[model samples]
Target: MTTPLPQKSFHDVRQALLARQEIALVDVREEDPFAQAHPLFAANFSAGRIEIEAWNRIPRRDTAIVVLDNGEGLAEPAARTLQNLGYTDVALLAGGLQGWIDAGGEIFKDVNVPSKAFGELVESQRHTPSLSAEEVKALIDQKADVVVLDARRFDEYQTMSIPTGISVPGAELVLRAQALAPNPQTRIIVNCAGRTRSIIGTQSLVNAGIPNPVSALRNGTIGWKLAGQVLDHGAERQGRALTEKTSADAARQARAVADRAGVQRAQPADLAAFQAEAGRTTYRFDVRTAEEFSAGHLPGFLNTPGGQLVQETDVSAPVRGARIVLADTDGDGGVRANMTASWLAQMGWDVWVLDGSPAADWSETGQPAAAVPPPEGHTEWISPAQLSTWLQGDTAAETVVLDMTTSVNYVKRHIPGAWYISRTDLADALAKVPKAQRYVLTCGSSLLARYAVADVARLTGAEVFVLKGGTAAWITEKLPLEHGETHLASPRTDRYRRPYEGTDSPREAMQGYLDWEFGLVDQLGRDGTHGFRVI
Candidate 1:
């Protein structure tokens, strides 16, 4: 029999949150189930992803971590994994997610609750101005002096957008708004796929004191669609470039906003000090476009576009009480990092903007690869061509392919006849697969699959092989790929489908999502653990 892991009561975790002590309230289930219900601050770190994600996200092995699941049996394996990963302080929530409910903790739904809730709270306190979707549409129809700025990512803008909107993702809004709308009389409209980014983006310009009038398109694209407006598909309007003068002026305004929001400015020495702190978890992020970061950036800083970083804080920095240090290559000053830090500070983070020019040796370029722990034992790997030949062989009937990629990716495409399996739950998933003489493991890069090879070999006592390049390499080899969920060994709990994502969400669900956002402020108040304060 297994000894139960040490546990923390709901009060214990809540106290850590309220006291602003370093604690990670982690839910080990996949996002789909986690989003259905969890404490307001619970960060989802699915059991299977701990090895790849925990080090970068939590950063400090000694930080208190309380893992929970709604009786899904994922927490125990995850806690053990954390311990194996050299995490010194790992524990379980006393009664799982149920304990929080039993203790009268306020449960919240959907992902990025902290950031989304903060957006709602900001609007509630600041009363950030907004115009109805219909009102904005009339302005566009009249060819009025207005430029709609989509606060979503560029790809999202391309998927669908307002007829004449420009892609100026959240963090870029302040830095580029002036150049995009030079005339002081132009009405600036900000929008996103949903309310949070729209509210935050518009409020950013307002707080930065942009001269032109600005307002969020109320409820964003969902509202636009509900109002019977036709969204343009495949729109590709980018935010206009800024001249030196405009960039410098924007930097000055951004600094002022950061100052007003109490964001601390940090130099390299200060950042070095932050890195040397043994007991604290500090995330160093370069808040710039990934391409810019790839060209060159300060060492030890991860690339997280400022907009997405703010939108998905729970994922980017799951250690709720950890310190965050943001760096940017904005000219004259760290405009992007400053603007991002201002919002983070208001969201109750101890954040700093690393300012000034990066030295020549800030020459470290490219994104850091996930440092996946290697497999305990090795398995033979076959090239895509070899696998293709084997699949066409007479004994192919006895060979089973296990695809360990995300369910969504698996649904979209996979190796022909591959059985989808949640690697963390492989033992049980194996029962659903046919008895076979050979088993193969493959994922996106085969990096994740490589780790699973040893586990599969141990479980099935069969000849297990890993695809050398994963599914990506197979596709690159011009092999035929299969689509759809042909065989699922485990449930598709890897991701949560947001009502605001994609263009095909049901109208009822869209309205329901909007209604959910409306109540977030009250929920935040009741929870009383968030340290958010809008300036």
Candidate 2:
């Protein structure tokens, strides 16, 4: 038998790390757990991503690596996997992460890595004056000079954010901060689900060289809920402040920003004219958070969060030459939209921002008014009655029914014979979906189902249909609903759990898997390999 690799003690690893030795401390934990607590130097490497993403994460083979897991028996195998990948100096931590902590060694909290740390810093400094739910309600009553920045992801902000807080994700802080307050003296605050992001985000600006004092919304909205503060929903946040700048003023500012960035400003009439123009690929993007986008955005506008749009323009708008129009709410929304427009212009795209703020009422603007059409080439519209008929008809042997709802709903109940596809996994699933068969898309609501139908149709050119009113409607009608398998990926076989979904597998396993997958993709790109596509 081959000789077993030697293990290193916590003291040995600590000494090595403190000496500034070239080392990569990999915490084999799930992101959520890892986020809560981790070694200051530890980077996450889930087993699920090992094959695909790990290599790219740990590029230097010479750097000594110490892998850790929570009392779970993953540390040894994970180290071995690294060794197999040609990492010459890999070892397992003595007793995994807990062992390190138990050894009376110092553990670091809030060790936000580069990009995410940078995002947190932005939230800390620029996205400031966030109010707790109760505080915000009080502010509304008091009419204070404070502006609440919903530092959570846009979708979350849209779904249920403090009514006063405008959606501005953590990453967009640097670019949009200046426009958000305009007046440097205006108190700015940042908030998230809990204290971590809000606290760290507020601190980031303090760390940055920005000339502003910032603070976090204490405990975020959760604290507000605990305090029994009520949250406003739907059209409550849409009402415009009568005393604030008029829509015309906001439009003029938007036009000026667009002009400065060398982007065209599309007035309502111009948009109508552009829509009428033939053969031009025009993509309307509501560059807001998902929640806001979902909470009644322009018909036909795709929800591409501003920060994501800036970072992943190629994926968001694959058509390089297409005209892109972005919309956001007033203040923070305009800031993000204008910032993205600036970047698109720099990249040689014909970009534009909608002339005015995204108010509740856009009906007065003579812009092209039309419902968001189903994805191009999607000819089939299945009614509730037609679904049974369609299900009965033999379409293909491998027809996949993908439910893109929240994991909780998927776990509670889903369409019979449907494979659950969480939103996070949509892109990956879309890529792997067989081209030969039709795809059926459903969600908690009809809107998401319709969107997925359009998306899959666009990406795969697959014959797709949306389940009208979605699973909620189906459940209400007392239609059949199948309970999804408790474990989608076998823990024994796959070695990792799906991160976003609930799974029996350890968090370290999932992180390792993702790290491996990312590494593989990087290697493939470096080797000039192609044809195998990621959704």
Candidate 3:
């Protein structure tokens, strides 16, 4: 028999981790068990995903790796596979997690790995308190004294959010919280889907020792959905309304706090002059509601909204020490924008806000004319004669077809051999597309196809062409259309089930979620009247 592999002691692994050694901890349990609980920072490289997403997800081949499973079922095989893939340092976690646990090591729980641990910290500190869906509805019914602050990314909030919640992302909480909740008596609640930032945000206020009692909207919009609550999706300006406790009052308090914090705002001309200055990197943001933003706003402006801009500034603008300019449509936007600017100033960024309305609305005052309506949809029908000619000619090896329509539509039907990539995943997908390829973009509607062309041109600087009227026009004109799965693979359909939250069966995930909510309700009861309840 071959000699047994060297086994590392628990202390050795822990020491290696503390010293920041090049180590990849792999939990080899089935996806469900692994997802429920594992060592913090452990990457999931299941047998299936390893073959497909491994190269993309984990690019380093020289990093040391340690694999573990419930017993030893998958550890050896996974280690061998990584070794075969040119991983220089790969080994099995001797005794696996059981040995670590037996040695009294810690294990973390929750969905989405690292985010859950962060959320747990927020929850433990009471950093975020949230109302259940029922509680929000009841509050609405009772006309209670509370303000709802949505802490999700801007796009997600615009797509769907609690009816009354005003968008104020986590990073901006310290700056904008006072504006959303002025008095110590007026309650403030933060929300995000399934905790994380909502909890972290609520806690941030508490940690800063704000006078008001702040809580998280527990479980966020997802919990709201599971609670059988109705979400307001039709475009409406619910954020414009002010309760008896308003953001205006909060703004006054925030301005006072800003004075104490030594924060400043910039006038429109000052901002314009700054933009004109050379060798300076600046990101201008319009922090208005999506509807107001899409209707008409500044040129070359991204509609981040107040809440999400605060939460995802790092992803939105990764460069440090860059100047930031914010624009708001009304009191809500203005207060939130100023609040975010204040924080960035404290964080060593040169931040400013426009003194007046966004540029798109300045047309009435003889500013550049109002934004022109985007062009109507087009249908570029390639004649049958033209198609024959192109087919006869040599096909470019560096050609790619991007289908930017909805996933559901792509599944139902699409052009033959076209790569299906949703708009949401465009930024990431573009990075993987070979620069050598001449991309041809298409979508269900010609409008989206044109938008894809523009995006490709802006992002890649590569030659791109649209399919004229998109796949719809192609089919309508009796042109050939391809069907069935093409280059795309199906997403993982295996659902995770939690026994602690409910049963081990897949059907019990929802029930388990409900059970967790009930537990939260009980905890809230003992914790006193933070003004939240579960339905």
Candidate 4:
């Protein structure tokens, strides 16, 4: 018989947050529903993705973790999974997500609530300067001495950007703002897909004491669209490299800001000491541009560009009270790491920046390899060519194919007649699909699908084979593709469409997103556990 797991009440979790004690409040639901409503710091750990993401997210096996689920029935199984995977202190919430609601815990909408709310807090406290989208448009129309910087990812900038704006992500603002607008007479405006990045990026410039007058493009591209202003698509503009003196100066200013925010500086010895503490969870990250990190980075340090690190802190460091160390090879002080540390410190993290300059031998290169567990059980595999032939012929009726790729990818391109399902939800999802004499599973690379082979084989009581190389292999063979929601065996709970994203967000939604962000400062106050402070 299984032993009953320990349970933590809503008061227990709140106390831990308020006291700055270590506790990970994990929501074991998929992203879509989790985004719709959850407690402020509850990190989303989807039931299907536990194996692939757990090790990196919660590095310390003994760290306290509280798993919660609504009516989804995932919490207990997830807690068991964590225990099986060597997590020693995993438990269930006292009454689950519903319990939290009943106990008066705040339910927040959207992903990255902690970071987004902190951005709002920063703006409210500092009263960061801003220019309306209309005003920025007029400046551009008049060919005024103004430079606009987009503080989002480059692909996001390319999709749609303010006219004459160049990509300069949040952390890069301090490092490159002066280079883009050297003249003090020039006005600098920072914009993002929405408000968070712009507010943070604009404040970063102000914190660094950049000579040019800096302000955020009020409400960003959404505001531009709302104001009936046009945007430039496929913009490839970027800021130039900074000189050694300029880089050093930026680092100094960033370090000062981080100091004001109470960020700690760690030498190599200090990092070693922190990692040696068995009771603590330490996350080491290389906070540089992906391209720069790929060229070379320190061993054992995962690469998450600084701007993205701030935006997705919950994803990167799920253990709420863990210690985070940021690294960058930006000369001695590392402007990127320092600036990133400042924001993280304000967001209530015990963040550190490496003090010493990196040595010549930065050994590791390329993206960090994923740690995928071996498949559930041994199974035969069918090649893409063979599967394609079967699909075109009579055997198609006897064979059923399952696609475990993300819904977004499944919608873009997938095998003809392939049904998409979340592997973790297979039991319920499989009942929807017609059973056949044989079953086949495939994902982007067959990496995740192979794990589902045993599950499907047992469920159907039929011959099961994994598609070799998965869907990518089929695409490589130039096989015919089908798009959209062709055969969905499961609800598309893997993705949550953001209110501020895409070409045609309803005007109401865009305004509502802004309105939600505007009220976050008050929400944070009412929640009272964030511990955020703007310097």
Report every candidate's CA lDDT.
0.89, 0.56, 0.56, 0.89
Can you write out model 4's per-residue Cα lDDT over 445-478, one digit (the tens) per residue?
A: 9877887777788888988989999999999999
Candidate 2 residue-wise lDDT, 246-355, digit = tens? 33344444445456658777776777777777545567787765656666677656677765665445335533245788877665437557656755565456788887
lDDT of 2: 0.56
Model 1 lDDT tens row, 221-301: 999999988999999899957878778888999999999989987888888898898999999998888788999988788
Model 3, position 63, has a per-residue lDDT of: 53
In model 3, the clashing pairs are: 127-202, 127-203, 129-215, 129-216, 130-216, 130-217, 130-218, 169-307, 380-468, 380-469
**Weakest 10 consecutive residues of candidate 2 by summed lDDT:** 526-535
| TM-score list, all predictions | 0.98, 0.45, 0.47, 0.97
Question: Which clashing pairs does model 1 show?
Answer: none
Off by over 4 Å in 1: 1-3, 330-332
lDDT, residue 321, model 3: 38
Cα error of candidate 3 at position 112, Å: 13
Error of 1 at 191 (Å): 0.4
Cα RMSD to the true fold for all candidates: 1.3, 15.2, 13.1, 1.5
Best by TM-score: 1
Query: Candidate 3 lDDT, tens digit per residue, 1-535?
Result: 8444556656666666555343456665545567665665466655422333333233355555677776736677667655656666677777887876787666654434333333453355443456677877787678787887776655556666677777665545655566556667877878765565676567556655568877777766666767777665532332333543445554554455444444556676776777677545567777655666666666655666654554444334433335678776554535556655554454345667666655555332212222222422432334333433443457544556677665557767876667776443356667765564467777775445554555566688767666666777766777556675564532222234333221122324545653554354334333221222110
